[model samples]
Target: MTQDPQTSSDASGAPASSRRGLSRHLVDIAPLKASPAFARLWIGGAISGVGAFMTTVAVGLQIYEITESTFAVGLVGGIALVPMIAAGLWGGVLADVFDRRKVVIASSLASWASILALVVLAFWEQHLQGLGTHAPVWPFYLVTTVNAITSTVSNATRGSVVGRILPADMLSRATALNGISFGAMVTVGPALAGVLAASIGLPWTFAIDAVLFTAGFLGIWMLPSLPRLGERVEAGWPVLKEGLTFLRRSPNIRMSFIVDAIAMTFGRPYALFPALGALVVGGGALTVGALTAAGAIGTMLTSLFSGRIAHVHRHGIAISRAIQVFGAFAVLFGVFTWVGMHSGHAAGEGWGGTDFSTLALMALAMAGMGASDELSAIFRQTMIIQAAPDEMRGRLQGVFIVVVTGGPRLGDMYAGALAAVTALWFPPLLGGFVIIALIVILTRAQRAWREYDATSPTP
Candidate 1:
């Protein structure tokens, strides 16, 4: 039998040295060197992502400021959920059948328009006061839902484009790079949004996102047209059914989705950050930004030192373990919040009035969760890209996007609802344990998933 290139010795066939150089752990730039198109897309996305995140933070703040309700804030995700789901399924079909480049460009334009609409609403609320003392929150939800739908489609197309652009071996490195991109956006975007919203105002903060969106166009414009790889099918249920059928057959891929859904649904704590900063941790917007950025900090560090991730042959085991670690950290975060509540530390008044000690502990726990989540993301994405057939990549990627994005929305609902009824800390504390138990049970039931190997590309 031929030795697997991933684990085999060099041409000499001698045992490979176990000692990889220190440089092995750093962010691999080889993918950038190999594909200029991918590099451009990556850089453009990174630039635009910061602006997008700023908008995200600003919207949450605006909603909270208007209503002072965590449930209202969480409803943002709920409103977007169904539309995003439809877009994911339909968009995957579009990506597979139509020109992916065009699909991305069109979706990007829609997303840009949504951001611009937000900009208009923000300005209107500040100067016109058209809807009363506070801006009508419904419009915010309407525009963000549109943005979510378009962005979800755009993401599925973009992910498909990556597989077409890069070689199979480079997929893992590319996944790592993608993690770094996300980490950068999550870290810088929220922080910038907080500072911008706090200093200038919400209108200007949203305007920045609208302005930054232009960068994405530049990257997509440069890409060569990418047509469908298989027999072109109409963009309808038939196309979606085909993809679903494939997923049903692919146990490893299905398991990947299931595990991710479990983690996101149970372990997501982001929806509570605004309330925590305002009512629990007490640094206001700044504290929210810090807590939000903490997870990205962990993600960034993990990606930076992800040198050894590419060598792991047992991707299934890695993904499972990483998610478990994420759950553990999430549980820890809940415990920290519970302790702070019991300690009777009054919530801080504003940005400067934070409970730093408790905030630090919570941030640390969130960071740990972020790091583990990123690790799991890297492996799961690599599995999807490498294991699935090229023709099915977009559809699978669409499902992946749904799981990735939809899971958090569900988490938002879970956290928001549970927090409204109980203490802010209860959801994650309960969810984390649920994640660990469900994942262990599910993985054990699916023997194939537990023993999955990257070299063979089973899914």
Candidate 2:
């Protein structure tokens, strides 16, 4: 094994895939030392992800308790979309123009600080008389906004770091590891958040989130300094324009974004979880935990042995197939829930978890969706990180951040809107089918995406 400064040139330059021959279709995931730097980052990310999950659950629970409306919870996520996108793009641009490590550090600190603010609010709720008496929405929105912004920035920077540290050959392994971390977070964080919120109150969850963010900071701090990729530019619209221009030239990348957006917008079923848990699923909060955890469990299972995917040169095709699987699962999830509703088991009104007895079926559907999503994510993330130029990584990341953040919100809108007109289960049932059909159609229509070889990428 050897380390060379000139390796990146191979990634971007002509002969297309000198990293591994086309014949080398698979590799052992564990032996790919890939980069120790990335390994450290992965560990830190897992920690932060767990805490982030806790905060997410806490925020939703608190909001639901305060407003007693599912709409409010969905609204919080949708409202934060703009700032998150802006911060992500800006953060990516900064990563490209400045030291990525520094950008990550600053943003990580900001994220941690926001959580600390949440911590303070928790104590205030417990101790301060006036502060706790009048529960305000603005502060909650503000803290959430700050958290979203910083989180996007941090993600963009971290992604850029992945592009830098790992050889092209091991991207799948890296992607798999990322999936595992996220899976673990979802599996661990939400359940913990629910318990903490139930027992210790909401503030403590935020405090835990603050502590978790620190692990990411340490990972970034420990990294060797890296120069900005490509060229440097001023921090405003010019940088943004450059990134957009790059995206425009690349049909696959653009299409990838569109595909993800569609799936997220229509097929996302998160906002409906509470409703399903209460009215249809037959369990209470526990059902929600099981459903969500089921999905994470699916993702974790896939990721555990995903070492073989590193050999795949055709990432585009992989993503397309994975997304279709995601859609199919979503449809199944909806079907089971819909069945529960038709069986005269509703929380009596709108769709709340209706049948706690049906928990197993719901969990299976959620798990399917989870597996498909994780697989799709592995390819999508790899494409984004490696294909984009180093100079515009930040801005691109910002855009990426928006897509990631807004996808579920769109799903929320899909579920909420469809539920208003039709039924709670209709959104996923219909949305899932639509997603699978569209992703398959789109990928087949676009041959370039299918041929997007990771080793020697065509941008």
Best by TM-score: 1
Worst 10 residues of 2 by lDDT: 8-17
**Candidate 1 lDDT, tens digit per residue, 69-167?**
999998998889998988888888889989999999999999999999998888877764554577678999999999999999999999999989988
User: lDDT of all predictions, in order shown?
Assistant: 0.88, 0.74
What TM-score number comes out for model 1? 0.95
Predicted candidate 2 versus true structure: per-residue lDDT over 234-345, tens digit per residue: 7777867788888899887787787888878877777776666656665545555567788888888777756446546798888888888888888888888877877776
Query: Which regions of candidate 2 fall more than 4 Å away from where they truly are?
Result: 1-34, 122-134, 230-232, 342-356
**Per-model TM values vs. the true structure:** 0.95, 0.87
